[model samples]
Target: MSHLSPRLMRAMDVAAHAHRDHRRKGNRVPYISHLFGVMYLASRVTDDEDVLIACLLHDTLEDVPQEYSEGRMREEFGDRVTGIVLGVTKDDSLRDWRTRNEAYLRHLAHEAGDESVLVSCADKLHNLKSILADHEVLGDGLWSRFNAGKEQQQWWYAAVHKVTSRRLPQIGLNGEFGELVRVLQRL
Candidate 1:
């Protein structure tokens, strides 16, 4: 069974506060909902609290550096959780979406640990679910929500599934992610 210590509760506060004002793209849904969704999905696959915490805070460094930095995260959650969060974070300084995503893919393939991979798979899975759900309602208009359009989005999700599935072939989430990527490809 998974244990939720005080540390996990503290991480929840940190994530909720950091993303308090943010909303998901193309809609007004609270961004913290996505964080919680990732944590819940990761929880389904593993009991490691650190991985679950990383799932909660995965987007902090990328989305809200002003609210939470690497140093602050380390001070609050220790190295392992911080490392996993860093593993999934992309360098926002790179303005070009392709350049940013390429760097992220390299980090995911070479530098991320198993914990990071697990959190990333959960993160992507939650994102895919959100995208598919939104697409069903918004149709092609949903593509406008992202920085990159449909083709680029397809490329990125497919590439992520390829890397994540290879890294974690045993995880059932990867299988689901691959299937979702195929569904997205057809749209």
Candidate 2:
């Protein structure tokens, strides 16, 4: 049987509510679909219940309704789940998106073994894969907005390589992820 319990189910419901009106950039697909994709990818690695739950709700505190406070998250899902979610949540007080993202990535790189990394990587891999797929449809505009610049792009590729190289060896060095990494390196 799957390890997803009633608490996880409730948490997913809360995330769905929080992101109800949201859509991904470029395409208007429901944002929760992205969360599902990340969870699916994480499932391919370890079935650690906390990791799966974190994958499902990683963005709730960041992208969801303002009412979804850390306190509410702790009350509903307990402190550990809140900690994992907060570990991946970006501090929006930064003046620039790139600075915020860089700090977030640096934090992840520092907090190496936290289950949050698995969710964060799965989340990033999902976005990267979508960016690759969307590139054919959106053309250069999407890449232009997402890439930040050649140096930032190269740093991103290198950072992803460092994390995945250390953490995802069991996920194998083949398939969509491997191809995506190669493409990022070329950018």
Candidate 3:
């Protein structure tokens, strides 16, 4: 088991503050919940302090760069944490939704290392659970909350699963992720 340190707590605080105004897409739930969910899921797999911290802050660089720049992350959390977060962040410069997502998928297949893959798997796993729950309530309406509709979303999740499976086959989380993907597809 990995012991939680002051830095881990600090990461939670920073992520909370940075995402304070943000909400889950098309919902009232605070965005920090997703960050915490990712961190909690990752914690079940490894005790690495940096990976946990990276999980907490993974979206900051992509979603709220103004609040938490790479420089700030490096200064506060150090290089490995910053690198893992960067590895998972989508290329917002692409503008087109499909283009950005494909870039991310390519990164996962080619460039992302174990730590990045671990954080991404946890993040996607949490999102899949939320999507499944929300789908029960909203049914087809839930697809409106996302940039891509059902088909594109399915493709993205499956692609992420493929990369994670190849990248971290030993990690049990990949199995859960794949199961969730299958569930989502059947919905």
Candidate 4:
């Protein structure tokens, strides 16, 4: 087994516990598996310890209400990891999801040199890869959840492409991710 620092191991354990009963859309696999997938991908792309930890904890603030506080994250994992997680979490109350997404992407672009960007890119890449895999199995429903609408979809597609092209050359286009980008553009 790969050895992780105590802090990182604790973050993974906390996220796993928080997401214990949850399952991914369509597949229904234990949601912690998704977190592990993201971290694994990040480890492949970058050796940054903070990025790996952030990937492990990425969904904790967004999906787990009880552990969503910034202060709690900071206290447990320190400011850097908490900031990265916070940077990626969406505000569901926003009336305009596209605008919120755009803002978040823009923030990621600005933070490109930070470990947060690596973590966020890994998270998005993992999600896009899963969608592509599900497309192979579930077909249109995968597109439906992601498609949203033409303008929103186009904006996200273009935005992610722009960011990936600019910031994530380390995670080069390959395998399912390349296909998913093509699928997004076709939508």
* Best model per TM-score: 3
Runs with alpha carbons beyond 4 Å of true place in candidate 1: 1-3
Each model's TM-score, in the order given?
Answer: 0.96, 0.85, 0.97, 0.83
lDDT of 4 by residue, 92-133 (tens): 676587777877787777754456666666676677767667
lDDT of 2 by residue, 39-127 (tens): 88888877776777777789888876385888888887788888888888888788686888788777877874557777777877898
**RMSD, every candidate, angstroms:** 1.1, 2.6, 0.9, 2.8
Task: Output the better candidate (1/4) by lDDT.
Answer: 1
> In order, what lDDT does every prediction score?
0.90, 0.74, 0.93, 0.72
Task: List candidate 4 segments past 4 Å from native.
Answer: 111-113, 144-155, 170-179
Off by over 4 Å in 2: 1-4, 144-154, 167-178
Name the TM-score of candidate 1: 0.96
Please name the candidate that would achieve the greatest lDDT relative to the true structure: 3
Pairing residues by index, what is the TM-score of model 2? 0.85
What is the Å distance of residue 23 in model 3 from its true position? Answer: 0.8
Candidates 1 and 2 compared: the better one by lDDT is 1
Q: Give me the overall lDDT of model 2.
A: 0.74
Off by over 4 Å in 3: none
lDDT of 3: 0.93
lDDT of 3 by residue, 1-187 (tens): 3666899999999999999999998899999999999999998889999999999999999999999899999999999999999999999889999999899989988998889999999999999999999998999999999989999999989999999999999998999999999988887
Query: What's model 4's overall lDDT?
Result: 0.72
- Among all windows of 10 consecutive residues in model 1, the one with the lowest summed lDDT is 1-10
